[model samples]
Target: MKILLHNLTRFGDLLQSQPALAELAGQGHRVAVACLENFAGAAALLPEAEVILPLPGSRFLAGLDGDWRQALAAMDGYVRHVKEVFDPDAAVNLTPALAARLLARRLCGEAVRGFSLDAHGFRHESSLWAAFLEASSAARGLSPFNVVDLFRKAAGVGLGPGRFALRRPEAPALEAARLALADRAPEGAAGYVGFQLGASATARQWPPDAFARLGEGLWQGLGVLPVLLGGPGEKALAAAYRETCRAPSADLVGATDLPALAATLCHLKLLVTNDTGTLHLAAGLGLPSLSIFLATAQPFDTGPYREGCLCLEPDMPCHPCPFGLPCPIGHACRRAIGPDTVLGAATTFLAGGGFPAGGYPGARAWLSGFDRAGFMDMTSLSGHGETARAVWLRLSRRVLRQFLDEEPLAPAGQERFALPAAVHDPLAEQLAQSADLLRLLAGHAGLAGRNPAMKDRFLATWERIRGLWTASPQLGAVGRLWQRDAQRAEPDLPSLIARIERYAALVAAFADRLTRR
Candidate 1:
């Protein structure tokens, strides 16, 4: 059977979706993927796709300041091209964009999944697709499955441990990358550690100063060479790091293309990078990597796909928003994971060193690739059109309304919202934290998806808060009780809820202050 998959998302998303693409091909089915021209380079590295259909870059269909007829007409041509030449027995639109939905409807395929337009041309997603995509959003702290599994489930394929299969890097590019590295740092050619200084979002990118400190520490302490890598967007950050870094380092950012980049990653001893496409590539290549997950980057969702790979993320309420929401107080999550923590992680990976564990406050370390059963899985993350804050806001508002014993806005005569009421502030960050604790407690009690990581997160968080809430007796007592219950082999649900409500009431009191009477 010929299966067509259209992945019109960004580069990292394209890289993460490869496991399923490889799976369909490995099953002896003819597989074709509609690749965006921009990501055609990454798409070329896929292991087994019988056909690759190139779609024009996003620039082609971008709306003009005035008339958009010309662009619309051109888009119709691309749609016609796909329908005429290589339509498949099955099609799946991996992206949730409206344009992709409309195009999926136009494509000639008998069984189409994922985002599509129905008979009425309204956007639609399969129940499985909806659930899978939702797994990556703000409620990820509550989600039991990884995104790579979600992708397989969305495609109607059997799920288990996933693998990322990639074609070998082009020999020429591989050699070219080696030569470039040699020219930059002749003493330690392939023994260097590459730093990816850029992520798709600035929110997710670790601060340049932290990388500079880490690079210096790696060179000064571990006798390891530091090599930097990124696209054009990272040039400024790369330059900043180069200026501040005291140790000898090579700034290879923007110098290598995707093929050469892949080639170079093979030579490196390890990569310490932001949560980006390159991180996924390194994982696919079986490279030992340390990925930093800061603001809006969730480690559990898109952490490395292999064991022995490490991840560093701040244990803050706002660290893992799907959209990379801006921090009001600045990038606290990125700043919290200082150079010392990264240095410790790097040294442990390199010079056979035992670094101090979990010394840094507000930061946590995670080893990727293993599930509860100890199998390698290619984990990925996805988001519905909602943020974590959005979910929390709704939940907070609904529960708060229930507490108030009346709906704030109800039909009064002809007006639906005639009543004057204060818009209830969800106090999302507070609510999200409450939710995280509850989730952890549930996992620890074996009531929810119990796992090692869940316990680690719960313990780490419990320890952090146990001290800070000393002033608030009610909150502190409830939290201590919750922690005490979590340590038990079997936790009592009724007792847990009583304590949970004690903590919830405290948070609700703050929300109550913000709520207009």
Candidate 2:
């Protein structure tokens, strides 16, 4: 299967999506991905990907003088390019921006899948779905899964529930990286501690002094060399840390591209950095890294997914989403996690006592060597037209109308949407297929799907409720799938009302889970 992973966000976001593309390739599917111009270096980690497209204008949107029109045009160009070249079996929209998802869906046509945040209301999601329905509306087009799981589901492959694994660069690149480090600081060439002092903005960054202290400790106590890495914007910050810190270190910030940095991090024994792309890059390159999260971002999205790393957050009432405001109390969160915690993790990892190839103790070994037999059993190439036709037929707005509730255009409608068809139709097919692939792969390893019966029951319940909702005019039109199916002029309104009960139960179950903790 040919898969196109579209990310119109930041370089960090592009790096994060690498795990998803890897998941597809691990399952033996041909995968290509798009990133903003600046993030092209990160795409190099995805050797399995067939093509890496760049949306230059989208990269511009990440900066201070960002423009929405240029970002949209770049996103459109990337989508059209993928549509013409890959003609992907599935298109995964991984950008967080709702507008990007909307435009990308139009450009990709049908066979699209992606995620949406539950902002405003379910109706906002519905509006998005309406656009999606126009593209490809399967039984349940959009899946409400986490970012990582979204790709797994999109690829129609089961990675066996293991931690995400990133591939190392070519041997020559790796060797060159090591030599580059030795040139930077000859005496501490045995091993170095990697540091990233700058992030996209102040909100996501830790205090420079905090990084300085950590670097100082790594040098004085662990005898580890401190190597600061960041973009050109971070040069001064890295230089400042190198000057003020007690340790002997070199500032490589703003000095290297993604590939160079990734290759270099591969040779480093450990990485201590803020919540930024470098943190993720280190993990992807198999470096033992510790990530310090500011109160503005949550660990659920930014924490290191690999082992041999520690994620530290301060105890604060006003946390997670600072909403563009700096911590008023002099950034206590940064001060609390402390340099000792980072240094301790680094010492334990390099000593090889706690960290292993598979990561920390008890961590499962990563999936390696693409399993041909397992993939064969799970998926087979269908006639190009057969799958495309099936996909096209499924992308109906009327069909998508079953999953939404109320019209998104009236009253409080921001016309927000969820899984747009341009994003979900192709993805759901892949997800449905992933169930089979997961079962096949796990079967080889004496493993079985977890909660199989739960999924079965859920699907059964979902179908029944959907049938009921679709049967009545009231339910079909405004009860369930109204908001998401913008193209659906008429829906079974009564069926939608009937299906509301199921949604209520789902909300209740979700609340119960949250309440239990």
The best candidate by lDDT is 1
Clashes within 3 Å, all models in order = 0, 43
Return the lDDT, model 1, position 226: 88
- Candidate 2: segments with Cα more than 4 A from true spot: 26-28, 58-84, 96-99, 115-146, 150-163, 186-190, 355-490, 510-517
TM-score of each: 0.69, 0.63
Residue-wise C-alpha lDDT for candidate 2, range 425-481, written one tens digit per residue: 543443343334333332332211244545555444445544553443213322234
Q: What is the C-alpha lDDT of each candidate?
A: 0.64, 0.53
Model 1, 1-517: lDDT tens per residue? 8778888877777777778887777788888788799788888888776667788856565644335887777778887776667757778777777777777777743267766666776556653334335323434533334456556656655344578767778788788888888888847433799899998778788988888999888877766788999887789998899888888888778887898889999889899999888998998888888888877666656776666677777756555643434568676676878888778767876876222344544466666655443323322221211333323323333332222222232212331111113222223344456656655554463532345566566566566555443323113323333343333332455665454454555454433333222
CA displacement after TM-score superposition, residue 207 of candidate 1 (Å): 1.6
Clashes of 2: 43
Worst 10 residues of 2 by lDDT: 373-382
